[model samples]
Target: MDRQTEFVLRAVEDRNVKFIRLWFTDVLGFLKSVAIAPAELEGAFSEGIGFDGSAIEGYARVYEADMIAHPDPTTFQLLPWRTKAGTARMFCDITMPDGSPAMADPRHVLKRALKKAADKGFTFYTHPEIEFFLLRADAPWNAPEPLDSGGYFDHTTLDEGTDFRRDAITMLEQMGISVEFSHHEGAPGQHEIDLRYADALSMADNIMTFKVVLKEVAVGQGIRASFLPKPFTEHPGSGMHTHVSLFEGDQNAFYDATDEVRLSKIGKHFIAGLLAHSHEITAVTNQWVNSYKRLAWGGEAPSYVCWGRNNRSALVRVPLFKPDKASSARVEYRAIDSACNPYLAYALLLNAGLDGIDKEMPLPPEAEDDVWSLTDRERSSMGIDTLPRNLENAIAVMEESELVAETLGEHVFDYFLRNKRAEFDEYRRQVTPQELETLLPRL
Candidate 1:
């Protein structure tokens, strides 16, 4: 066994871990776990544990159902807030029984994208500003009531859930997830947690773990934490405005001291690529029927496709640069909701950015004025574009995009397209209470 595997073995024994959970995610980003006793862990590390992939959504066809879960030793950590006997978990990579990477595996999708970046001597890093809501436990599942009536940065008294948030942060820290900041967000009962920047893959895993920890901590209280993109139509919706930067070796590739915004040619091109592909990747980033509600609403959710310095109204914004902090230079992509599948979302993002780098796509003019407030004439004159307005439209956009199809590969691309189409159809078929309430009384 290698050093990391051996270390995990020793650590599991010392920690008195009764079970080691092998965790991965489906295409929709829902976490899936399978546990093994300590006696079976060494074998799992060497040979991997087998599972029926066909049973998993977007995984495999019935005939080709056999798949293996190879636990990632680096991701080994004890599950914090586990009420049961000592339990640990590790993220796993799904592969075919013949040792080939499963093309449908979201992790494999990201790995391919990362390998492309590596080929160019670049590494992608991300810091996500994840936002969600804390609601009363007994609140109706469909219409959850906020636990508190506080808004943005509301202190101890206003933000009544400080203890719960603190407990969540503690649990996350215990599991080795570093949270940079946690504060009450603009919406009532909504909060934002900014995770420390890390490589895309590790950060994706951290995000998945972060959500679980948040919910677990919330359950411990008399409340429930939700990651639904737009739980309340009247209030601002949750968003995962992600900060992205690229690096080469010890230096930041995105930074250019000579440039006005301190952005390198590479950085500018990368942003240009992102803008060009924003619509194409929208389905993957904000992949839900309700996600469009968040996108369509113009508050913090961006509908227009444009980039600018510190312009929250634009889909992409280059955060203000500090004179001494060159490493902090990055672009924040604002359209992604907190509920997205980080694995596929991050993969698509990296690929989109790389496409820009590869094609040397030129950066468009910065939209200093609020793109959201602009009239059609003004936006048209400025070449400003808009993202897909709904899930069905987003799916159609994804279907036609050669770039999206190529990035996701045939299997995932086909599966994702079909799955999202069905979701949109189902959503369309439903007669929402709002529709009935307004139409029945009016007509």
Candidate 2:
């Protein structure tokens, strides 16, 4: 066994870990798990545990039923909440019965995209400022009520939810994840926790852990932690505002000493590529029916496809760096919501940026003003594009993009489009209460 695997096994034994949960994700980025006894750890490291892939969503057909999950030893960690049973967890990679890489695996999709970035001497790092809501449980799939009346960093009345956030951050640190900042967001009971920057793969794994930890802490405190993008109509929606940068060895490829906005040539190209493919990759970044509700015009969220410095209304914003902190310089993409699959989202994002670098695409002029307030003609004159309004429009653009098809292999791309299209169609057929309220009385 590799040294990492051996070390993980030793740690498990030392911790008295009885069960080791093998964790993975489907195409939509939903976490899947299977538990094995601690004794089977060595065998699983050498030969993966077998499972039927055909039953899993976006995995395989019945003809290709046999699959295996090979755990990554470096990701081994004890479940902090399950200390009574002494359970450990490790993320796994899916493989075919023949020991070949599975094309449908989301982790493999991300690795393939990362390999493309690596080929050009680049490494992608991401920091996600994840926003979520603490709510009472839903009665019957209906919207849940917020647990706090506070808004935008409010600290009034020192509620139990405040204590929940504080304790949750402590637990997160105990599990080896760092939280850079946490505060109340613009909406009621909506909170954001910003994570430290890490490589794309590690950040993806951390996101899963963060979600699980948040929910566990919420449940312990008798509340529900929700990552739903648009849970309420009048309230601001939750988002996963992601900051990303590219590195070459130790140097930040996105930064330069002498440049406007302190962005390098490569950085400009990356921004351009992101804007170019923004419409195409919308389906992956905002991968749900409710996602577009958060992207609506007039909200603080981005609706126009333009890059800027310190402008939240733009799809991509370059955060200004202090005089001494060049390495901290990076662009934040505001289009992604909390509901997306992090692996697929990062893959398409990196791929789009790299495509710009390969083609030497010129960056568009920055929009310093609020582009959301402008009329259609004004926006057009500014050379700014808009994102797809909904899932249907987003899928239409995705279906036509060569970049999307190439980035997400044929299998995933096809599966995602078919699934999303069906979703949009179902949504269209459904007559909502809003429609009923208006049409029923009038008719």
User: Model 2: runs farther than 4 Å from truth?
Assistant: 138-140, 321-323
lDDT of 1 by residue, 307-397 (tens): 9887889898899857347788888999998789998899888888889989999999989997778898999999997899999889988
**Model 2: residue 218 alpha-carbon error in angstroms:** 1.2
Residues 332-425, candidate 2, lDDT per residue (tens digit)?
9999987899999999999999999999999988898889888999999999988999999999999999998988889899989989999999
Off by over 4 Å in 1: 158-160, 321-324
Clashes of each: 0, 0
Clashing pairs in 2: none
lDDT of 1 at 156: 65
Question: Model 2 TM-score?
Answer: 0.98
**Candidate with best lDDT:** 1
